[model samples]
Target chain A: MSEKSPEELYAERVKRVLDVAALRVPDRVPVFGPYQLYPYTFAGVSFKDAMNDYALAREACHKFQDYFQPDLDFGPILAYPAPAMEMLDIKWFRWAGHGLGDHVMYQYIESENMTADEYDEFLYDPSHFMMSKWLPRSFPPLAGLAGWPAVRTFMWFGWTGGYVGLAAPEVQEALRNAAAAGEELGRWFDSIGQYADETKAKGNPQAYAGFDWPPFDIIGDTLRGTREILADMRRRPDKLHDALEIATKIFVEYGSGAAGAELPLCWIWMHKGTRNFMSDAQFGEFYWPYLRKGMLALIDQGIIPVVYCEADVESRLEHFADVPPGKVIYHVSTTDMVKAKSVLGGIATIAGNVPNVMLLSGTPDDVREYCKNLIDTVGKGGGFIMDAAVMLDEAKPENLKAMIDFTKEYGVYQ
Target chain B: MKEQLVSAIADMREEEALQLAQQMLDAGEDPQAVLDAGKEAMTVVGDRYEDGEYFLPELIIAGDMLKAIGDMVKPMLQAQASQTEPLGKIVLGTVAGDIHDLGKDVVGFMLDISNFEVHDLGVDVPPEKFIQAIQEVNPEVVGLSGFLTLAFDQMRVTIEAIKEAGLRDSVKIMIGGAIMDDSAAQYIGADAYGPDATAAVKLAKSWTGGK
Candidate 1:
């Protein structure tokens, strides 16, 4: 080969990673994850201990991160405080350390000021607010950031949901405030931005990278729940619309000016359960405008807007058909890989849909075989990345290791 | 920096609401007349949400204007209700270990519009108060809300508490929130799951149907 420049060499190494993304050749599928939380039992540590002791928290996260060696690095910006976990301290919100009770964790709080009439408005709160009080109260997120300075930080910017059924007056305000609070979060992010590049390059540079954060998830979570929001769309249409409007604006601003190249992307936790609740018109009316506007703006910012969407987006792929190639990555959750690959064509990247249940419970051989088959299937068209449908809270550590080993060995073109 | 109420109900022309309320009242409008007019305006806004024309801001403004009118007519509604059964008693709060209240607030407003007497317990409620509230207010229904995955357990505990206390038949419990699914409602022994504010209103209405 002719003498290659340093940029070209770096590109070559990255190509191995991007190749799976490009679907250029059979490549190692990286174990990228979405919405994965720690199981309270793993490492025999509880959520309370992890929240209180940096070492404990770091240890638990590192055990998995090291075992997985996830394709992307740990993002540091996320190291900051969580709002809901602190604001809603009923009983389990405490950090007592050890046992089943200690593993409980929560990040979103109920709204205290809203009434049922304003349910939708509360839902629109920009998914962040009153988080500072909890950040320092429990684990000291700023302190946690200091531990792993190499990973790139990504925040749960916002959630996308349909207003289906409805809720009680008090519950509506609490949920709506979940989104409306995102604007106040700008100040917190401003605090974290101060450390964006200040991290000294440790062995784990992945932990220090800063991503353009989207503030949308305050209302919806893929692994959690949205049945209520979906219901509200149908029962209390007016209020649902009201809340979704504000939720949409905050994220649009987040994906646009506020993000400013923190790698303009959104991680929408679109889980299973109510996929059929809304008609396409409803999807367009309720979900598309905000997603289109926010994602489009992020793309305009020169950063590819990847959507870490869950479930089979294949059926509704047309909803996102307008997104240009390399501009989006919809990580599959419930669909078959090979089929999703064919449907997605070559336009965008497919991050994952690997079932954690199987991997966590299967043998090493089984893990290798399953991944190999998936790589062979979806990896065929290029633009594929191997990952779990979502993060496994209780996935066996050994099986996780097996998945990584298999990917590294067989996922390469060479 | 912002009129919380005005911003909350951005969809209504506050300017119009102000005029409509005054106009309807000036033309020999009683307090009930003004309240009825305000509620009618909100109904239009609610219809828009159902039709998919208006969104949350409009609903909020409608609610905001209604609240403004309610402020003017609270004594009247209260006076009428004192002679009759209270409009409807509602027991509401975020489940224990969960502190988000936005959803509850919206539910609170919807309750008012639908004419249910609301008793808000605030967030981070334990199972005992849910039981205690049921004993005290003897409300027609109880609402349990949790916005985080970490708080689903609270729903379960409270529902069980209501059941264990043998209050399941006396007070119907409704559960709704972002992290909650139908399974949680069933697990918590709730009578129903009002996934949104409107559905919750329907459930609340249906609960008090015969009473």
Candidate 2:
């Protein structure tokens, strides 16, 4: 047989993943590169350099792709622009060289960015609330935004006085800071886009186009925080439900809008709805309804929702069975993959069960054995994508090579 | 009243639990009795967590209720000049280069309520800081918490530092976090690994010779 071109290889790879997504047995199980900071580490790039230098980040990503050659390319999206974060003075995360060691990956610092009693205000006008409340509290450079008038008041005659708020010197300075940070972000996105195009040209398609969060996580992770939002579940159940309802609409729109026609997949990282985060009953009440709604909305847009279950979600597997067949992908961490296959197989694509700890600490033979077991079970008869349980950062090179190479060789379907 | 307080806390009626505790104290009840009821309620919460009836949210709210009630009754208890000793002393902190505190704080709260004097060194604690805390606190048990993969090395490094300081034998160390398991525990040279805060409390209880 003649050697296939990159275009042929790319088309075949995309078909393999899409076929698996639709519950058909593809040529072989797709192996996603379980990388977040691992590429930088593999390429000998410091976390500080990766975050600050977009070109270096792109090089690191390319290095990983050329070496490992996984079916899907892990893009440079996780390498956030340190310059933009510095300009915005964001409090949500502390990246390397800013608030951490030069080699340390960025860590999210969760706090109560929104108060409990302000749910009504947030539900009333999320745009205004974000501008006047959330943004100011999260971004110190945007503290002047707190002085701005309600965004809704900027219409008609209200514009005369509303424009006065924007004229304030601090607000102007805030606008300048925002503009500068936005420009830096645009450069970062350009760097990522360039990497995506380059990888695609080399027959390696990116896994997902963009990312979103469940409505409950949007409130819990970014707005009210893990502790505060969980407290709100008991303190003000009604208000919490109302806020989730509002957040559901916003996220559905945001998620569907982020997907492109070429790669219609939106990644949603499920954080607070895991097994130990809440009771199953609480998940039913506050989490599943809206998460299902968001997933269905994206499905309606012909976009696939790749839900990454962060912790053991064995208890919540039944809740996921409600989704449409073959339209969602559940990439899980600590979830029982055999049970996940039994519950979600043929209904939705199931991916991941490889332990991150094993990859980081175990031997290559251990990784091969684990992957062989997973292929025999979860990867049986297709509809499974092989990936690590979590986003890998510091993994042994031999173990990672074992996971990828073993999955590709052993995951063939008859 | 004590039964009502316990049920209120266990049932997650935060306002009622706080109000009921204040009412009991106002009625000239023993502050220790009120504190004991709070502890009993936490025991219920911990049991529910073990049975999977409760989770992090319940633990947090229950912890907050106990802390609030304790804040209210502590001064009064001090006035009476009667205080019981803690079960044991524990030095706890999230190891170096990791800032994740939700799990660490949950473990700390569980340890605190279980009657361990927890000298919480907070997040991103270096090896030297752990050594300093161990020397100052002289705890019977030490807990090292880390949520990221990078923490495995840090935990090992911190344990080595403790060993270098010649305090390794003085304290029994147990590590807990999301990514931790028995293998990690062995790799980090800790005495044990607790999967959750409840298990952590159990480990502390077993090590300190407390029920």
Candidate 3:
């Protein structure tokens, strides 16, 4: 492995990810994860510091890459800008020292920023409603948006009076802070970009090729709270469907617009479609149609959609058969791996079942045993990517070291 | 007529359920009988949820339908004045430092439909608030809810505060949410943990000595 050139290693790593993504056998199973804020923890930097200090955040990524050296890298980890969150006074996220200790990981506050009664307004003009309604509600700094009707009036025949709102002292101060935050965020991204380059130079291909999500989840996760959306499902199924239609259009437009005609190995974060969240009937009615629309949108653009199901999705297995074979990948955490293999073996690549909880608490021997079982079973038909069930926030570094080590040694195909 | 009311609720016909409930009351049917029918409808809802015939929407709609019936029946029941003891009283909240409340809301709604008097403290509730609510309401069970892993510590802190306040022995403590499990329950010194809302209801029922 050490004899190979960096370019060769980069090509081989990308090939492993793409090969498994296409339901074909690579030389061995690829190991990757959605590691957010974890590298910061691994590098002994508080997430608060990492968010504010681009160098610290980049260093964390470098440290993690150097220590574990997995087949693929989830780049730019821990890029959340502290200044921006503080400037917005955002209620959506709780970073260290906000509501938690300096070392505690960031927590997303999922509340009802959008109530049930606002479906028509949101569906009619999602962009307008999001800017005027959703943003104002989610972020306190943006609450002054009511003072600026330029957004509501369609730029008001190109008038300059709308600038009056920004002249407000608080709004001006907020804008200044926001400009500073944007600069910090840009620097942070640049650091991540540099890290990505360094990882490639070292032969580790960045794993998160791109990101997308299911439409229903896009709304349910960010717009309306879970309870609100579920209640809306029964109370106003028609209005819910109407909103879903708009969301599908918006997601597809955004996904295609950002990626152009094709994207490489797009990661579709799947939530609220799993078995525990909904029944098969509801999954079909409310979740699947819109999800399929978005997935097909990406698939039509020749992008491989690697959908990472957030939780167990045993009952929703048969729905994957509707999608074209080898066009998509299913990544799961708690769903039965063998069942996933049986259901999606030929039609799509099946990745993951490694429990994050076990990694945090289990021994290296346990990690090796589990990886061997997964590679032997789900890895059998050459359509499996060995991965943890969820994003790796914090794990016993040795256990992760053991997992990739075991897979590389044992997961090779003849 | 009562059977029809049950069917309307069981079938998740919200408006129909409300109408049938009102009609039953207007026809001078016992208000207790109307409440019993509503409760039975929730039983069916719970059963369907477990059996996979229903989803969260069904549970929410049924809870709304029952609340509508409850609004009508509760007034008449007050006039009739039987003064029966409630099945149990539960004080619930998302633990301090965590704001996720979807699971807590589901559990609260389920307990409400099942006839448990519930006091929901909403999200980001400090341990002191749980202690204060416990003192004010003297509930049979205290439920700590959160989804973040950090809430595990908050649960332990809250349970410790309850114990420190000398109320631990008087009430059962149950922790639940997306991140909680039996081991979390044990780690936090909670009496039990509910994997989901249905399991929470069953745990509450068992603690209250109710069927």
Candidate 4:
């Protein structure tokens, strides 16, 4: 595909919008990625090659939008210190997104079960180590071929969260130490946020939450680990309330960097660990309230929250059924798309219900039928955006083209 | 039947209006009459949900009323009457190795209003507990929920226990939550599957018919 010059394209000034209190026309359906395989692959660039020199990725994004015409453009070169730049004790502690198990990184675990005032053990601290370079490893062997479907799976893997600020254990002792770590994490954001704003990271100053929480990798580390904290809400309700109140307060203070008021942006949030499969009572009695409060604080701070209700959220809808529309967007899964559209349609802009499996496994006819049905069924009013239930991996290039072609032919209302 | 009892249930203070429903039932008011009253409220809530009028908070309140009234009304009837009661009985809980329970709470709410007698066993329930509950309570259906991969193993143990206890045929079983699929239902030997609370209630009734 040939390219379009900056002057040739219609300008819909895009920037990361942190305020989520209101809504407006986003230049187009925002395209995002944990891996921008479509761009990198076209450039004859491996994720590894792009790591060597990232600007080479610009053409790939332009070409993809030229071909696929996504409203939002994404870049996969999320910066990290190169692999050997720091004392990354990868051999000892594999990085698992500081606390909430995000991804792979310098995982030098300084101590184990340090919950009982046991800092005497080796303490894992990023302050002690130099910045480790984050180099992208190879794509799957099948990927990067001319026609291979570009599927970039970054939901759980592409993570690098560590002692940016004090994690769960250090939150108690050295309160000052935790603050220092947080400040350091904030300072590190200068470059990351820059790349985030780079025309490539889908940087739209007018965008939302720096493209949905700067990758859950970074947010999960900062927001508070969900497993123990949310579980505590049930085991000890009052204490959980107190902890959640404090955590919510902290979330407002720290999480303000993510989204904004005018236009809410959200990740298609996914994780094997914390999905919507928990019992309804548990979602109600324990987690939803805490999450509701955190979101309330964010909305109060003038941010609109688009929750990509991951997995089967059919059981949890009652809790969020009251969330006001124009402030919420739900990226739905295939498990209960009909009910989701029925129950959540008026309150949240329906973002998706496309079948991820069908795109890869189905033929052009099957893909066309499914996507057309999705658009017709989910796209009844104007609030719908065409997208997959989850991320699109290296899909059959032809299938991806089929989707793009269909959207172009059928998406316009004029 | 009066409408105030239905309003009270929607208000989640079933205890306050329990007498109204009892009065209706005692007056030779058909069980269908009492059910209609509750369902009227639930229907509004369910419609509100479909129309995006009601949220989880309202649903929870509606469910609370149903459970409270259900508990109050059951003792009034004889044991044999209990078997032929308003929807069939369901034993619901979260799976093992996972302590989360909110989804189960909503499922309980959905089942109760759909007219099932839901015996909530709470979260982190092991396989044997499910087996014992099925035997002692003799529910017509068992609804199992799991959100964790590790808990899938427990879901298996639960179905096996049902089969092992020779109670599988007597009771149709259902499974739900974040990670489970129809295949999982087949793998765990579930008779039915619910992707969400609304669908769960509907699926559960399809098997037992609120008998």
Q: Which candidate achieves the best lDDT against the true structure?
A: 2
iRMS of each prediction: 8.5, 1.4, 2.9, 9.6
lDDT of 3 by residue, A226-320 (tens): 76787777778898899888888877766664353212767778878876677787889999999898888878877777788877787888997
User: Taking the tens digit of each residue's C-alpha lDDT, what string does model 4 give over A1-414?
Assistant: 126444233233233111111233332333322322344554455544443233444445445555665544444434232332222222223322322122222222222111212111112321121111111111112111212111222235422232322233323333443344455445445434454455433323223353333122121222223333333332344644444454455445555655543334434343311333334555565456656666666666656556655565666666666675656655655546667667766666555655544444446777678667765675555455666655443455676667666765665443
**Per-residue lDDT of candidate 2, residues A192-213 (tens digit):** 8899899988888887766899
Between prediction 2 and prediction 3, the one with superior lDDT is 2
Please state the CAPRI-style docking class of candidate 1.
incorrect
Cα DockQ of the candidate 4 complex: 0.05
Residue A342's lDDT in candidate 3: 86
* Shift in Å, residue A236, candidate 3: 2.0
After superposition, the stretches of candidate 4 with alpha carbons farther than 4 Å from their true spots are: A1-10, A13-66, A77-208, A211-231, A258-277, B1-211
Compute the lDDT of residue A117 as modeled in candidate 4. 25
Off by over 4 Å in 1: A1-31, A34-41, A46-53, A66-208, A214-303, A308-319, A331-346, A349-414, B1-11, B26-28, B74-89, B186-191, B205-211
lDDT of 4 at A309: 53
TM-score of 1: 0.57
Models 1 onward score TM values of 0.57, 0.96, 0.85, 0.48
For model 2, residues B1-211, the per-residue Cα lDDT tens digits are 9999999999999999999999999999999889889988988888888787888889989988988997998788756634469999999999999998888888888787777898999999999999999999899999999988888889999999999999999999999876678888988899999988889999999999999
lDDT for residue B119 in candidate 4, whole number 0-100: 96
What would the per-residue lDDT of candidate 1 be over residues A343-364, giving only the tens digit for each residue? 6767777777655555444577
Best by DockQ: 2
**Best model number under TM-score:** 2
